[model samples]
Target: MVTLAEVAEHAGVSASTVSYVLSGKRSISTRTRERVERSIEQLGYHPNAGARALASSRSNVIALMMPLRTDMYVPVMMEIAIAVATSARAHGYDVLLLTGDEGPAAVRRVAGSGLADAMILMDVELDDERLPLLRDSARPAVLIGLPSDTAGLTCVDLDFVATGALCVEHLAGLGHRDIAVIGEAPAVYERHTGFAERTLEGLRGRARDLGVRLLHRPCDPGYGPTSATLARVFDERPGTTGFVVQNESAVEPLLGLLRQQGRAVPEDVSVIAVCPDQVALQASVRLTSVSIPAEEMGRRAVERIVAKLAGDDADDVTLIAPELTVRASTGNAPG
Candidate 1:
């Protein structure tokens, strides 16, 4: 095996210099770094992982804790996970995915074992059980969602409150007075998932300010539950002419049901969605939507954790602003 010493000899630099370049622990001139890299490539030198860890006191791995629940939107979660892994690789680290099934013990195991340098947690609840453990642990960590109390925690997520308000504002501007909101699963609300409740709070508060009559219903994501929820919504407020749907799974089913019920979108009732841009573009009716920025959130979370591991204090919350894209599903509310 070609060793670091051989690469250092080829590059005319010391082995410690080569180590500094690889670990980014100290500044190496661009010219020197380039020379070291070239020497490493030409010599087919691969650093021993165990030696590197011993020298750096870092495992060079990041743990990502994701929810195992089936009720959450799986596609968006998958996208975030993929983004985290990809971004971690770009930063010269690997990812360890731990499902929520392991609960707070997973946090302890990873932090205690020194198996990972840091952690990024997803699907955070308002009062998550893992928060206390994370706060007490020495390992640096970042959260992908907000919590009820953000004291001493590093968090990165979309501003769901603003996202919800943006959806309501768009509909109300289109003269949609009687509006309905299709929210996430009942279990999600019951669990007090921070984003879902925050979104609802923003929507409701803005609707009241806009003088729009708003009705909200928590729904399971599928045809049957959505159909039932839609029926109840219209039954409670028959004059409803606007909808703000936060559930991705219900988006298509809602559109299909509206068509089946003979309601012309935008011409009769306008709809706005909270989802990824891909979902909006591919929907049966192109939806005027506020995007979740899942990939961006994931990338930012990893960046924060990386910073934390590099001795930067990252204890504040980072909320990405919501962006709404105009598309086919929304128009002037019908008379």
Candidate 2:
């Protein structure tokens, strides 16, 4: 078998230098490091995982806790998970996927067993059950969503409040007075997930300030529920001329229903979405949207946890500013 000693010999460096290159405990010259890496690759040298862990006191793995619920936007969640895995790999670590169903116990188990060097949690609620355990554990951790109290936690997420307000401002600027919001599932609000509640809060506060009559409806995912929700929205506010939809599953359905009702988009009504850019571009009509930045959030969370593991204190909450893109679905309010 190709060994570390052989790689070191081939690279004309000491075994200790090769070890330092692998562990990153000490810096080696860039040229020397590159040479050692090339030799290791050419010789197909695979280090002993157990030996490396013992030497560094790190498993070189990161645990990612994701929600198991289907009610939320599954595509976005999946994209974040994929991004976390990819980014973690780039940082020389592997990812351990744990579902939210495991709850706080999972956090304790991973921390106690040294199964991972750090953790990144997703789908965080305002008062998440895992927060206390994370705070008490020695393992470094970062959250992909905010909590009610961010006292000592590292968090990375889009500023959902600003995102919501941006959507309203765009429509209101175009002379939209009566606007309706299609929110996530009722269970989402009942749980008081920070993002959902914050978005609603921003939307309502801005709507009031802009003198726009806003109606919000929590919608179940699918054609039937969305149809009923749309009907109720118009029934409650007959003059509604603009829409801010947070529910991704309901976007296409809402557009279809509006067409069926003979409402010409932008000419009769304007629509805006708070979703990933891909969703906006592929919709039946190109949608004006405030992007969720799922991949960026995931990448930032992993980076934060990795930094924390390296003895960097990462206790601050980082909120990515929201950016709205204009497209075919929005226009000046009707005459």
Candidate 3:
């Protein structure tokens, strides 16, 4: 293994000179710097990240805590994760992906151990258990999902409330009076995930204002659960003429089930989704939908954390506005 001492000896300079050249803490003469650089290249001497972090007090790493649960869609989570990783890299930081459901302990461990300079949390519940620790810790954190309270936190997410309301308004405007929301899996709602709850809040609130009858059904991912949920919605509201689906797993199943039941989309019923644009476009039916801005949310979360790390202190929740695209799958209610 090549050491700094070897590079220093080879360059005919002191070890301190090599340290200064690597850290740029102090200016060195151009000739000396060039000679050290040549020696470093020739000897293949690389400064250790741990040593650099200890000296600078910054690891230049971000910890992303994302719990992989079966109930939620993996692709969307992966999209956001990829975005976060790439964005962090662009900002000269590496991502330490912590896929455990470590709750608050993960934060304490990472923050205390100096393994990462900051954190970005995902799959946030409305009243998250990790918030208190994050609030008290001096280490910077940014959430990709919004919590019920944002008083002392930085968060970035899609405006799912507006997302839900937009779906309702789109269907309602098409004269669909009875709208059914195909929500996330039962466990997701059971845990009171912030996005799911807020979306429901907006759906119910807007439904009341628009005089639209709304039925919400929490469905597991796959054909069987979606089929059963659809049956229940139809049984409860026989006049149901619209659907607002938030589950990516259920989109194709719902579309297929509707077809099997002899219902033509936009002719007998209209369906819209709250999902990514890729999901909307690739569905069995090109869905009229509110696109989830995963990339933007991920990028913004990193930006906020980077800003905070640089002592910017601009702690505030950022909600990306929802954009609903009208595609092939929506139209007026059945006459």
Best by TM-score: 3
Better of 1 and 2 by TM-score: 2
Instruction: Give per-residue lDDT, candidate 2, residue 116.
Output: 90
Clashing pairs in model 3, backbone N/Cα/C closer than 3 A: none
lDDT of 1 at 294: 87
TM-score of 3: 0.95
Model 2 C-alpha lDDT versus the unseen true structure: 0.92
Give the Cα lDDT of each candidate. Answer: 0.92, 0.92, 0.92
**Residues 1-335, candidate 2, lDDT per residue (tens digit)?**
77788999999999999999987889999999999999998988999777777776888999999999988789899999999999999999999999999899899898988889899999999999899988888899999999989998989989998988898899999999999999999999999999999999889999989898889899999989999999998888989999999999999999999999999887898999999999999999999999989899999998898888878975899999999999999999888
Per-residue C-alpha lDDT of model 3 across residues 138-210, encoded as one tens digit per residue = 8999998889999999999899888888889999999999999999998999888999999999999999999
Q: State how far residue 286 of model 3 sits from its true place (Å).
A: 0.9
Write one digit per residue (lDDT tens) for candidate 1, span 1-335. Answer: 88899989999999999989887889999999999999988988888877777776888999999999878778889999999999999998999989999999999999887889899999999999999999988999999999999998999999999998898999999888999999999999999999999999889899989888889999998999999999999999999999999898999999999999999997998999999999999999989999988899999998898888888975999999999998988999876
